[model samples]
Target: MATYSSNDFRPGLKIMFEGEPYAIESSEFVKPGKGQAFARVKMRRLLTGSRVEKTFKSTDSAEGADVVDTNLNYLYNDGEFYHFMHPESFEQFPVEEKTVSDAAKWLQDNAECIVTLWNGRPIAVQPPNFIEAEVVETDPGLKGDTAGTGGKPAKLSTGAVVKVPLFVQEGEVVKVDTRSGEYVSRVK
Candidate 1:
């Protein structure tokens, strides 16, 4: 364990406090007009998915826990584990459905991204920032209506739906903002 001053704290830095693991969310150094500077920190509890805020003297030190992250390629899912292979070493690992959550459903086969590990086990996955998936289905455009004010629903190959311009049609490959589940632009 390493002691890190509040000044050393940064987002995604993992620390152990009271036998639980937490990662820093945000930290701000506040200088009160009459008092010493302190660090206001927000942290996310890894086990419970809860957030906590606390203030510490700027020089206060805490035990820093070790966490690891690696860039990898999503190979495929086995219905149980979403498998990933490291880009450099080709070492592979899998995280289960619950851990990947809705992100797994958003991933296409062989996608490249990052995965975080704690104590040599997968804890979270960072999927690709964006993806281009073909629209599999949607209501047909109104016949000759020419009124484009309203948008139609488009379903992507990942089974996620987005409101697209009236002109988007089935089989069109559209760039998707995976984080927001929104269509960005038509690929072609």
Candidate 2:
């Protein structure tokens, strides 16, 4: 574990507070010109999926946790668990549905993901930055629906529903921004 001052903070830095791990989601250094400078941060709790805001003195330090992440490829789902294998060691892992529930809807066989491990056990899962999935159902495009403001909803191959332009039809592959869960563009 290491200590880091709030002044040196950056997004995605994992720090420990009160024995819990929190990733810095957003940080802002504010000096009101009268009082001491402080760093106001919004953090996401790693294990509990809770978000919190904390204010820290610019000179105060927080403990950095021992978190490790490894890139792994999704193998298959056995109904109850999702399997992943490391590319280097070929070791396989099974993550419970409770852990990867949200990602399962966007998951497809052989997708690559980053598994966050805390003390060698998977604590959090990160899906790909972007993925290509085929749309399964949606209303037909209107003849004059070119504004693209209020797009139609469509179910994707991975079971996630996203808004796409009316021109996007069923059975067409489209790119999705995994982080934002927004449809990017048609694949082909």
Candidate 3:
């Protein structure tokens, strides 16, 4: 594995710490008036999503994690594991439910997603930033109520609930932000 020096400490960099893989969320350089320079890094554990902070001296270094992200097509979930396949290679694998919890809500059959692997095992999954899903259920929109006002909860085809504008109706398609799980706009 390659090593990353303090100079390489930056967000999105994956490094190994105490036998676990961590993604650096933020890194700030701190130099005291009389001491050497150091880096304060906030990292999130790839496997658990827990965050932690650590300081490293300018001379300190960390091993780069053996992590890779590959695009895969989602197949289905059997109540226990989610299955995915590589489009070209046709390689398939079952990722644990816990590993894909954050992304499960936005997943749709045949959708392309990025799977993050560490040491040949999946540790995280990321859906597309934006997704268009059909509304499956919601209360009727009131007269004169528009999207600019308060929103209501609507269930989507993927079984995820998102707050959408009053004008959005059942069977209508709405764009959503996967990262924040918020409604973006109604699709025409």
48-132 in candidate 1: lDDT tens per residue? Answer: 5679998889878888866677888888888888899988898999887777776775788888877778787877777788999
Clashes of 3: 0
Q: Pick the candidate with the highest TM-score.
A: 3
CA shift of 78, model 2, Å: 1.9
All candidates' lDDT scores?
0.82, 0.89, 0.93
Off by over 4 Å in 2: 142-150
Better of 2 and 3 by lDDT: 3
lDDT of 2 by residue, 41-150 (tens): 99999886789999999889999978998999999999988999999899998888888868888778888999888888777888998999999988999797677476
TM-score of each: 0.84, 0.90, 0.95
Model 1 clash pairs? none
Sorted by lDDT (best first), the order is 3, 2, 1
Pairs with steric clashes in candidate 2: none
Error of 3 at 159 (Å): 1.3
